[model samples]
Target: MKERHTSLLMFGLIASIALFFMLNLVLGSVEIPVRAVIRVLLGEEENTIWRNIILKSRLPQSLTAIMAGAGLAVSGLMMQTVFRNPLAGPSVLGISSGASLGVAFVILLSGSIGGVALSQLGFIGEVTLTLSAIAGSLLIMILIAYVSQKVRGNVSLLIMGVMIGYIATAIIGVLKFFSAEEDIRAYVIWGLGSFARVSGGQTTVFVVIMLVVLPFSFLLTKTLNLLLLGDSYARNLGLNIKRARLLVISCAGILVAIVTAYCGPIVFLGLAVPHICRGLFHTSNHAVLLPASLCAGASLALLCNLIARMPGFEGALPVNSVTALVGAPVVMWVLFNKRKSER
Candidate 1:
């Protein structure tokens, strides 16, 4: 019965993901016909402009949203499970804040601190941004893993992670104040987050990186299952707790860094989707939960991307804004339903 229920839920989520994905492709600023989109996708179309719009713009953006949503959702599930905290997430671990700080260093301090203006750097400037974000996030994740080894208590480690995030944010604020308005504005948009920023060659690279790393997380399912039985029992079962924690965190951090590097710091989907999956599937099993969260996150992101670009909003809405507006309600619904079930 449990397996049957999980299968049904997974099928539903898969269908929703497909629906939202199609909606995103068909409902952008220029509403391309579904038939045209299908034809364009299959290389059976002659309309160059429509084909270009679908392939160059909307398709890449949709693909980006899918990867961003799936990667962050998986990262959040890892953080929450590792910390055993309901509220723990990718940002809670200081990963995204670290990425922001890295970006701040590049954008705000490019001329003054680095003695190299970003604009003059050209293509190298973009490379610098991605590298900086990855380096900063990796450094923080390494610190957290080290702290996890020494802290003993999950809550203490969690608290330390939060403190680390705050410190990173404070640093960024000071940089923003001293920086020029243009740089600050750029940073602000990056912080607002968007699925439309990545494209073409960059999109291929981004999606490939996610595809490679995401599967590695699934391999840890047996290990993760062991973890749910508590530390003592997991230890008894021959789980190398510290190594497992470090590996899991490293995976989560990389996912966040890559997504944030391209899409900015998208909010809520990561933190919310895992909870929603749990509520829907009624199981803690990583085998089912991970795939369900991936699908749910993808569906939610595509839905948000579609809404953000809707004609009513004139496509002016930020992905972050849409995610928060749409996601918060879903999160609340999940919590309320969970509580009601418990009651």
Candidate 2:
């Protein structure tokens, strides 16, 4: 009976998510009727404008949102599980900050030298930025894990991670101060995250990166489950603790770096989405939890993307702003309730 109930709940959530996604495609900056959206989707295009809008704009945006949502949520789940802290995330580990810092340096240095936009640098800048960001993330990730070994308390690790983020931000601010005005302006604009900025080609890049990393994360399910049983227990169970930790952190860094490269720093989806999944599903089994988080994250992001297109705004809200706006309340409620339960 419980199994039947779980399956029904999962099916319901998936169905609702699909419905919202279809609605998202139909309602955007220029409203295309639902019928036209179906036609375009089914390749029976009756209107060129609707076809163009669906294919050129909404489709790519939706795809990017899906991949980003899944990637970040998985990263967050892994980090929280590895750290054994509900609040620990990609942001808390300073991984996103490291990526942001690398992008900032690229904008500053490249602009001064060649007066070229990083996007204009094409594959070269993408490669450079990705490498730098991954390097930065790995460095911070290692530092945090090391500190975590020594720190003992989960709360102390969280505080250390926050301090690391602040240090990275301070360095970025100094870099910005030294940067030329044009470079500073470009970096600032990039900091305001956007899903629209990811081109179809960029989406392919992100998809490839994610595809390479996500399976490895999925494979770590057994190890993750073991680790949750505690380090001593995992060792007794013959899991290579160091190797498992390294693999998990590396996979997470790759996911974080790719999203940061294409979409800029998306804030709360990584932090909040997995918690939502856990609450809804009432399980921590990664096999179930992982896919559930993916669907929930994608649905949440698609909803945010839709709201970003709502009328009465001169420009769409940044994707980060929309996610934060929605995710903040949800996270606050969780934290508040958790505190109350403990008391």
Candidate 3:
């Protein structure tokens, strides 16, 4: 009976993702008809204007939301399980902050030091921002990976990651203070987060990177389940605790890094999606929780994306804002239910 229920829930999540994705394409600010959206997606639409909007804008945004959501959700689940803390998340490791710091240097320092604001450079600016974010995140990930090997304790490693985040944030703050007003404004906008940021060929690359990396997470599911059993127990059961920790952390870090690089530190989805999945499925088993988080993340992201771009808003709302509005309540419900159960 439980297996059947789980299967049904998974199916529903996939269906929701599909529905929300279609809604995103069809119900944007321009109000493209459902039929027209479908025709455009099928390469049958003859209207070049609608074709450009659908093909060049909405399609990439929808795909980015799906991939980014799935990647972050899975990363959060891994971090929570590895650290054995429900509050643990992708940002806890400071990978997102590292990406932010990189962007800060580009957007905040460029005008002050180089006498030219990269933010106004258009395509070149966007490309530079993306690359800098990737470089910064990978650098931090490498540092964390090194620390993981030496620390031998998840608590200590987690603390170090937090400290790294603080340091990065401090640097960003200093840069912001010295930056020009226009540069600061640009940085703030990037920090607000947007799915529409990754458009055109960049979206394709982001999707491909996620497709290649996300499956590697599933490979660690068994390792994650074993880690959940506690280190001593898992070790006695033939698991190499240290190696497994490194693998899980590396996987989670990479996901957070890439997602933050492209989407600009999207909040709440990573921290909330795993908990939502656990509450729905009522299981600690990663086997179910991992896939559940993936689909649920994608679905929720699509829903958030849809809401952000709804008619009245004209897509002015940041993706992060919608995610917090949606995610906070879900998290509150999870906590409330947990507390009641304890009672």
Tell me how candidate 3 scores on lDDT: 0.92
What do the candidate models score in CA lDDT, each in turn? 0.87, 0.78, 0.92
lDDT of 2 by residue, 1-343 (tens): 7578668867876786787788778886688888888889999987888898888778878878877888888989988887788877778778778877877777777776767867567667766766666666667777876776577555676788788888889989988877788778767767887777666676677777777777777888898888788778888999987677767766787788777777778889988988987766667788877777777777888878878877754255778888999998987787677667667
lDDT score, residue 270, model 3?
A: 93
- Tell me the tens digit of each residue's lDDT in model 3 across 1-343: 9999999999999999989998988887688899998899889999999999988999999999999999999999999999998889989999999999999998888899899999789888998999999889989999999999899778998899999999999999999888899999999999998999887999989999999999999999889999999999999999998899889989999999899999999998999999999888889999999999999999999999999988888768999999999999998898789778768
Best by lDDT: 3
Error of 2 at 169 (Å): 1.9
Look at candidate 1 and tell me the lDDT of residue 204.
Answer: 90
For candidate 2, the per-residue lDDT at 31 reads: 85
lDDT order of candidates, top first: 3, 1, 2
Q: Pairs clashing in candidate 3?
A: none
Q: Can you write out model 1's per-residue Cα lDDT over 1-343, one digit (the tens) per residue? A: 9889889999999999899989888986688899998999999999999999999999999999999999999889988898888798888989999898888888889866776667456567777777888878878888888898888878888899999999999999998888877788777877898888786888899899999988988988988888888789999999999888878888888899889888888989889999999999888999988898889988999999998989878658998989889988988898899899998
Comparing candidate 1 with candidate 3, which one achieves the higher lDDT? 3
The TM-score of predicted model 2 comes to: 0.87
- Point out where model 3 deviates above 4 Å: 338-343
For TM-score, candidate 1 versus 3, the one ahead is 3
